[model samples]
Target: MSEAEAVIRNQSGYINHTAKKDYGPLEFTGRIAGGLRLDLRRRLPLYASDWTDAFKAENFQKSLSSILYLFIAALAPAITFGSRFLDGTNGQFGVLEMIMSTAVSGVIFSTFAGQPLSILGATGPFLAYTLVVYDMAVGADVEFMPFYFWVCMWCSLFTILVAVFDLCALMKHVTMFSEDIFAGLISLIFIIDGVRPIIENFSENKMSLTSAMFEALLFMYTFGLATYLSHFRRTPWLLRPIRNLMANFAVTISLVTASALAAIYSSDTNLRMLSVDADFSPNLVLSDGSKRPWVVNPMGIERSFPAWAIAYAILPAIGFAVLGYLDQNLTSVIVNRFVRGALTLPVCAVLGLPLSVASTVPSITHVISLTTYEVKQLPEGERKVPSKVVEQRATNFLIHVLIGCALFLAPALKFLPRAVLQGVFFYMGIASLTGNNLFDRLFLWLIWDPAKYPQYHYIQKLPIRRVHLYTLVQVVCLGILYGLKAIKETSVVFPFFMASLAIIRKAMRFLFTQEELELLDSLPAEEEDGKGLSPEQPDLVNLEKSKENDEGEPAKATMGV
Candidate 1:
């Protein structure tokens, strides 16, 4: 086969040779059967065997970086969602519960999940739904715990049924267009959330205007410093290792430096520290100064399960199941496009589960924080691209375990400045947005000169109008989801909105040519091949091309098959 044909075949197998294969109607039984059979064959073996082949002595630095990145990353959501739960319910679900759930879920997921890299934690949508359920129970004059127990039990069953039947396979229809928009929106939310506190404090009349202004300025300084350090790679005076260290630990260092500065500068001013309330005890308790057991049976004979609730609960349970399945699988797809794993729904049922939230932020930040060094060429030419010393999964696993252990230290972590975490979130948001293809294309449109535009494959092959249309669709979807999330009542249906985006993507084939759609949806050939290869097995052809480019040689054209 010729080179171009080989590239196409290597990237997508037989898909390009035929008319694009249409996924017919969703087959419920077939999917279930497939999942069951696959489970029987692989689940036991995988569970029994060692999954930690990814961890090695060589990956120590990468693992350490991951632990540090996740510790800070988990802290934001833990505080945000934990506080939300506490405020909404007057401290019914305490900070300890939130931290405990996060730590426990992380440990369980990292150990058992097929994809260990995907981080799991308390999510805004799940927390919103919980509050809604709590309010509904209160309005109905029902005991909140019993009512919650029934819903969770039903939701767990539904989640298991979905997983056992392999309904997640349907997610194959979700293309990069949908994934990018969802991820981008999340990133934007992080940035907005970070800035919101400063804005709110600035407007408050309680604090003096000068103090408020100083707080806002402090945030800007922190954000600016973090962004600068994270992106600072071009300084020649700094040693290579030192430069890499700064970039890799930029967020952690910036947070510390900024916090110290704020503490000293705002010693007299009333600057806010992260509001975390924990007694550092293992016991679970109710808001009414009542003792609650750590392990209460949800379906106990003592508590009556209302007949009406059984009927009412099924719908919400299914909704939760859909939400869990979609969020988990979507996160897995985004983290490592190659490895898709099934979640244990039964476990989620027993322990109030945490959904994977803001996974890209931590994963990307972990990668960015690692020190990389460029290898010099033999003689006097351009240096090779900087390379990471280790992979990130082992670090991901360890971080979760550490966070679980760190729950006891919650009292100390409360002193960590909220503004510093906000600055980290701000950095995370910008990083995520910048990395998306849709954002890259949008940026290309802003450039006044076409000659200055980068040679992206889509730009060269697809009509510019079509490209813009595709981007417009993503932006519109992002706006809808973001709007839904901002409104409390609608946010629970965020997963449905995400599913709708996938459906919209499937419909796009009618509007655009198959080849163009394929290009938009599928991974590039180099990336596709690289996914299956070890780091030592470099793409020799690409390497050769890079060398030729460095030596200023004209590229040769490949013959068509």
Candidate 2:
């Protein structure tokens, strides 16, 4: 086969299955039924087996490690978003609500989702929409909770409708062009979010020099050391098993070590600490000036919502429903495959909690935590990539179970420094970029010499200009998304802006030739050869199917294909 043809044939991850399906001639209702069937079409047969594998005795050890890593991975954001909810909604929702939403929604997803490897949590856009709803309630002189409840209720209904209609089958239109830009934006959010707080401490000049410096040091220590240990397996310093163990537990080790480091400066008042409620009581105060109950009465909120408001709620609901659809499905596709999010909507809405969507960092981190990497010495350097992922639900199920348990441990969790968590944020953002194709290409600009470029398929097979053009297009789209997400007034349209990326990607055909696009966009040949966990086999892991050497090392990694 021609090199370009091979590239095209090897390419995967587009929603081709849905796009190509011949759901025989059907009327509207029939199509809707077919669409719903299509949602579970691929996963249904595998459902029973998925559950069996989840509880295998051998999976427990790995699940335990993953549980610890993901617990921290999931916790930081719950606290962060909870704080945002409290401030944005005037104590209508806070840490308690956020935790409950995550813990509850996560348990449901882990127990029933086709791909439980993906994690769900509140996202920034979700937070922005909640804030907008709060503003509407305030302007209308209505109770925020009732309006919020109705909005969430309508959102849940819309989300279910989208799922029922199988609207996500349209994902066939999305491509790496859009997915990478979205991934890049999410990654930058993590990196920037991590660095922003430390920089603010210095810029705002809020604390004593010693305290600020200590905070900065703590952040660096966590990020730098964790990064070093995560790659420990790549080095020749220890026994193979020992290095692997360290690499697997890198995040857990980093958090523990950082927490210990922060404890040394517990007396330093300027160092920010994680804030959680001493109890699990609702933060919102009712009209009677009493703490609201956990269960929000849809019809009996503090202020009696007008009947028109019930219908009016659909306006905001449309935005959130679309956002949830995109975030949940797209991130699912990014991690591995599509999974139904229709179930999470109503549950979160009724609880008056921030609705959870697929969290990019944590979901990807969950995959990485379960992945076993094989390191090989190459002429260039040591190439490390995923060989297999211990796909199971037990870890996710137990992780959130522990998160729910955190309600009782709030007093202890409060001791963790905010800077330490931010350090993890920085580490996660930086680590996630390791396998990003866009990130790799962006770094290519630094190499002026052609001979120095790594022997990546695209770099070797495609024209350098073609590769650069593809990367540039993604960069432009990322800039637009960043703008949309950064401005409050524009943020509500953020989901639509994300939708625009698919259109932008489609428009790229006019810019690059079909052959060039394939080489630039396709997953590597090994990935399509059935030796990876994610069908799309996204660049989230620097995966390459290495061939066997004379020593008879296995020709393929155990990808559980």
Candidate 3:
């Protein structure tokens, strides 16, 4: 046989068994989606015959898992933060509202739209800004949350526009380094934001930063121990359906147990117990002209500007436009990376003015958080991304449809607790960090004596002495930011400025020695294989995949088969 047919025949054999057990192989129906149907369909296989049904199933599973993931990523931090908000403001949402809200925006964004697996919901910056705004708006006669909801609706509309236009390709210029910096920016926010309250409450709440951190650490250990015991006992084994989605149920179990203990011990020892609710009564946001239960009509007064503020608005608008563009497209590009569904920058842009209004959280700031998912489940015989990536399109569509249904039912969701969701947020924050490559890279640079942790050597080209200099710069800068963030107003400025420093540093790269430039260039040249995990590294460690075989982008996209 010729080379082409040999490859095709092998791929065909591969797809038949993998895509679905009952399915024989991929065959085109001779009809396309654009209302073109031909009876004598050739049943021509995919461009790559190695596609399989089992692989498709795996992708579907990953998409489904995202629903649970989004629910958790959002609520875990939210529950804790919400409790703190109530402690600060004295309101309650019960467990239901807190949990539902976490899933609400995520469900609407993921389900109604193409980016089902994108995993949207509350972000730290948005929450920070919201609390500040909500507090400020309370003093004014005008509504607060109605404006927030209006902003979300606007952003959602913009997202729809992006999906229609298919402008996601504009994201090609965003690099891995840029993405990492943005993610670091978010994580830095988490640590600092999380720290501020802990420090302040240290005296009034009778807590210390070290003690709270220790309590958080203890909570981690408790969950770890519980997980180990659960696995060790093997009682949950009979629960197979839930077992496949163990992480989903894990937050519920851990937080409940932790809260039980906190409640019991809280009164005696002054352990901070989480608040149970997040008050969502339509306050100033909807009080005026409160006609429909949840709708508002803004009297079309020309959106005004103060004489002093009017001049400043345009420059900030330009700045907002730049940051908004960077944030949304960067997020869209990353979303498209893991998710099979198409993501468009225009979607973010369409949502742009709304995001600026509702919550001007930068899009690129998303990469700061991360999650790891299996891209494809390789068959026993076949290898590479050819397996799951084959039936990617159909599976993605199905998953989004399912998530949409869930979102439509989101308001009725019952039984989840606020603390549990907070635990989920805590878990997601920790889980997303799993995708970060920096911690180990830095550890290697600082502590590892070069002889060990060779992977660090590959990632950062500087020598041991130079590694110390790099570590010193990072530590000192991060320490200063951590300290200054306590002042509240100063926090946002530091991160934006810190990120700006990177631009300056990149420009300064030109001043380096030719040899230093060569060394700097050597980093990240080793590309990841399109495959999910490398076989060489057993425990989710990524390896350099052969460059030739990198999947160009989403297997299913505007490019078409």
Order the candidates by TM-score, highest first.
2, 1, 3
Cα lDDT of model 1 by residue, 329-386, tens digit? 6555221211212333334334443333424344444443343444345333434443
Put down candidate 3 lDDT per residue, 1-561, tens digits, no spaces. Answer: 124544654665633422332211122222221111110011233223322431454344443443334333333444454443443333312223333343333433433332222434334444444444334334433343333333333433443333333334334444443544444545655544544444454456556555565455445544453344323212445353344234224544566566565545444443444433123332112225332332233321223222333232233233332334345453343222212122222232222111211111211111111122233445432233422222222222333234334434333332333323333334334333334444444566545454555554334555555444443444555556445434545533443444454464465355554454344323343324534334222111111122122331111100000
The per-candidate count of clashes, in order, stands at: 2, 0, 29
What does candidate 2 score on TM? 0.78
- Report lDDT (CA) for all predictions: 0.56, 0.67, 0.36
Superior candidate under lDDT, 2 versus 3: 2
- Highest-lDDT candidate: 2
Give the range where candidate 1 is weakest over 10 consecutive residues by summed lDDT: 552-561
Cα deviation in Å at residue 277, candidate 3?
5.9
Residue 34, candidate 1: C-alpha displacement in angstroms:
3.6
Model 3 scores a TM of 0.55
Which residue ranges in model 3 land beyond 4 Å of their true spot?
A: 1-104, 111-116, 129-174, 195-202, 205-249, 263-293, 296-324, 333-386, 390-437, 445-448, 457-462, 466-486, 489-502, 511-527, 530-561
State the number of backbone clashes in model 3: 29
